[model samples]
Target: MATQIVTSEANTAAVPGEALEFDDIQGLVFFGHGHLKYSRYVFLRMKDGKQARARAWLRTLLERKEVSTASGKQHPGLKDVKGEHALQVAFTYSGLKALGLSPEVMTTFLQEFREGMRDERRARILGDTGGSAPEKWQVGGDATMAHVVLVLFGKDDADLDVFHASHRDCYQEALEEVFIQDADMRQGDTEPFGFRDGISFPYIKGVPTTRGSDALGLPINAGEFILGYHNAYGQYPFSPRVPRSQDPGNLLPDVPRSQRVSGEPRPKDLGRNGTYLVIRKLRQDVAGFWKFVEENSRDPDKSAEENEANKELLAAKLVGRWRSGAPVELCPMKDDPTLGADSARNNHFEFRDDPYGVKCPLSSHVRRSNPRDTLVDDPQESIKLGSRHLIIRRGRPYHDKFADGAEEQGLMFVALNTNIGRQFEFIQQTWMNNPKFSDLYDSKDPIAGDNYDPEYPGDEPKDYTAVVPGFPVRQRLTGLPRFVHTRGGDYFFLPGIKALRYLSMERTP
Candidate 1:
């Protein structure tokens, strides 16, 4: 028998007049499934003239309860649920069209999602030039575009394989496989770069958890992540809708009154409880990263142990955290494995005390990613401004070895947000890829930025220069090579359970 688990709705603090409907949301939004160590992502393209069959297969899966929801019981925290697994499905703009959604309804989605991550202009903004260009992508490229992505999680490889094979058999006739990406958490919370990742995440206002305030010191608005709610800007994030006449089966919920203009027709909400999902396959060069650090940290006069310490310090400065996930601002002298392991203390520090980036560089990966109090003079104001651009990250690391004996390993990056342009894309363009970030001179994110894109336009700096602040003088590390490259990526729409059913419904003739 399945273990009975309480829903988050019963445990979380309710919003003033409205409570989050956890049952309508996908489990990925609530939990990372860390207990399920193995994962597989299968990308599919629907077969020509097989829209009906695809929809039928989707309806069958929904009926069988294959797709997981945000229930505390179904969460990985529970133990010994037999054949326990998680299955999530998302679609691209092409996928929705392939499923027969009307053009009128499709236009309502965010333009960034409609144009996709591979659009020429977007690629430039995201620094997808040189080796990271879309043409070089293994999947989600022109020749390998996919319509749908099936995300599965399992306790082990065998469990994942069994689940994947079963689902693959069900949808094979309606959809053809485009690519298969597999990931595992064998690194135990550390990314391929040998630093603890996934250490920071935004806490939604209506989500119940024992964890305290996020690094920003408060819970962000639910509408920032989920549709049909108020965002940080005090307005509903735009969501797609279908005409009332089209939803004849009444499979979808009515659009909230606040979201509708007085003169417009009241449509059925297709994006309620749904959020946009961003997927990126980043290839991390572990050997290249370490080699660069080792070469740059060398000093003939220094002792071997001292050189090693310098190397470690340089790496930490680049990432803004020690190898064990401790923020360098708290323990800059050395690694504190114990402190890093403590969730309460590790993320509590702010950059205001070390304004000059003496402890953590202004251009460091973590600092640039989330500037916290440093964005403005007033810490509280900075927090409010930063909240508008937060994203809920759910990425995992993957390792694969090719037949030629070459090893490939990196992160299967996943992020969820309501507005792609305002949240995810803003972070990429304004923070990660900006050479002028924090007024730094010709520096991009040392770990993940597109620092050396040869095909980039204009006279932008082609090489990255890391700035490390010190008392008397600042240290500059130049000639840094690109450490991470984007292999494949795309924007997808992860619909609510009701929207899923609505998508599976046929239109009235």
Candidate 2:
């Protein structure tokens, strides 16, 4: 019932430092299937001191991992191509330690990875405050010990059998195969709340992200999402290194002591070809979300027909995009499927023209997630500044009907970035979670914000006011409800093939 993601078998297993093997890196990072019907997230914990076993399993899995350019005339097993699935992997801070990573390399990891998403400082800044602190996370305290994430893709359960048949025994023996989470792809590209997604991804060089040179968005530097390249700061982000004795063969890139960026200097290259990864299990209240919009869209003077139409329009104002995925910037008052489906046009619009919240509201999800050219006066400056905060988000919805067929369903939100501070967390904290964003006061991300703050009376949540010009009175929805909540997630590092091999073969000092 799900669409299958296909790849070629001509993947290169290169050990070259700068040349990244698209095949060795997870396929999910670069590909998405609107028809992908089945997805399984296999969580893992390292067995006690079984480094040898973990490495053995990893080496074998890496050989089979899907590569980037695997299409056209390829392996015989992928005849249908659409029916095949792919598997990719990454490791958390504790997971890396469990695999025998030493303190020296550990110290070189990002603060978010080393300290985790549960860091008290980050919790408060990102609106994870009050009775439900970071400690309330599903994987809190000692439970942050998740080591490996096995991202499995398939059209259905049957497709995954190939993966299990090949590595099940080794996975069980070498590492603890924690519970596997299967993401629901029932609504196609839409989330459970019924909104189309994955529509606007930034085009990056060398990754094969966009189809044409004239794609709506501008192409960004690969370093924005990958390590070892010039980042948004025009400087290479800090890469980890170890003593030459720890990696005598120089399988990794070496940096002299004076070449250090910020952290303490080391000789061996452990941080090269690696990127920071963020994962969050967000639970959504689909019914409550629609109900709130319906109730709030009502007006005594408006006729029933007018109020009925206002339901979707009001929701669009909050989301900054119609359920059809057509951006409100382009179709301010209507839904256009043809435009939404057109890759050439969907992401072509910007917010600089509609500055006064005439079309997309200031607090809308799109504006909050990506302010675009609206954040600054000069369009060129806004584009330049905004590009610095871009992040590659990869999320899949999960749905499991309850006995009443009303169970909780949400998305497995995943993000890729080199600097969690400047890229991912900055957007979440400074933009999405911020109550006052972009010169607007008391407004926040209407769809994904945690508006509850004890700083307000009755610990009551604040409202998101939407302004549509020429309408005279603005539409304000009071008694705002939190439509999404974080259940669990972690920060991990997706090492390059060479770095992954190091994890498998070398025992760092």
Candidate 3:
């Protein structure tokens, strides 16, 4: 049975929309679970010929109500509800196939999800070359592919330990552990690079949470993040489905009437209220990043304080925001801790006024990731165009020193989108990795872009540059090194609650 529909006051007043099925949607879609500081991503591969055991394990999780949902009371000033622990399950293409999904139904999924993140063509487009190549990836590569990923979150390390241990043996017969990635929220939500993170998120219509000014006066359509609804393009995004015969138990929702083909039987919605998850393990070179900034900004003639200020400015221009999360576009002259901490004013500004990129450089990390009102001559038109590519980020920074005396510290870059190609890949390839973004001749995103790779030959320039627009003449900072490197990543489909139940059901002969 479907959960009772509940309309939100925010959705009712903001947009004329139908009630959202919070009970069916996963909690991670709405909440980052910031309060739960400890997180573990356990990657597993289904045991060969253990489809029945795997289905039984999923049924156990659903029956125990271990999976988190978005039905709880909303928190004040934040989108998440108070929780001691959160558990989310997602499946790779291989995982779905292991569960015995028919080939015809599998073909209905997005091509990007089918090919995966480590596909050779995808790796090239994602700039995963040189040290960041898929062959060098520690996980989610061809040899280390994971069929399933269990996202576990807890309020503390003890809580996480207990939660993980409790379920450790539940799927032992059905799955084999491939790898584990653990992450914790740093103080003040800063990443290893010492900058505030998780500052931007799209306000989904009918979500029933206060986004304040973060939405930038535009709430994205629910279908942009969730399937089975109308997207910003005024059409339903392609979602995988199953024939009615396959779902004899009626564990899934029916395909909407408008979406049904004239003579075809009504199929079951396998992707309703679900979304795609893109997870990338990005390793940041903290020492190298500061060293480059210090080396480039040093001036013997200037006082130590003046030199320090110059260094901070250069680093801020590269990141497009001060260390405290205040966008340079809002305060170009100096760092404003007050404005950075103010949620109402921090993300409320636009780049239209700084058209020349004097404040925030066109090639800066934030600017490239989200051009925001600077894509076209008309600011409103640009915002509308940009809205289509928006993604909800729900990642956390990780730090760990392995037993081999190697240190690993970076961000577990996680994002949710209905269309991985149009949203995530488009931003990664067309905006961040593209050297010609914002009309710059040879500049990529200063902080996170794949600037150059000697091993892989392409149109990428040999040298990297960070351009800063100025009054007398624009200053170009050259000889930049790759600051962020991709370690491992993959695309997974986060199914809805009912879909999980449906997937767990045995097919009728």
TM-score of each: 0.94, 0.86, 0.94
Cα lDDT of model 1 by residue, 291-372, tens digit: 9888877789999999999889889998999999999999887999998888777888788888879999998999988888
Task: Estimate the TM-score for candidate 1.
Answer: 0.94
Residue-level lDDT of model 3, residues 1-509, one tens digit each, is 33443444443233445466778888889888877889999999999888899999999999988888876443222243566788999999989988999997899899999999999999988989988999999889999999999999988888899999887879898999898999998464898888888777776666554444443577778899998888889888899999988888888888898887788699888999899999999999899899988987788998999989988988888898999999999898689999888776778878988887999888989999999998999888888899999999998999878799999789999999999999999999999989888888788887889875555555344468888876124778786678889999999999998999988887632
Give the alpha carbon lDDT tens digit for every residue of 30-70 in model 2: 55533457777777887776777888888776565442222
Better of 2 and 3 by lDDT: 3
Model 1 accuracy (lDDT, Cα): 0.85
Please tell me which model should have the higher TM-score, number 2 or number 3.
3
TM-score ranking, high to low = 3, 1, 2
User: For candidate 3, what is the total of clashing residue pairs?
Assistant: 0
lDDT on C-alpha atoms for all candidate structures: 0.85, 0.69, 0.85
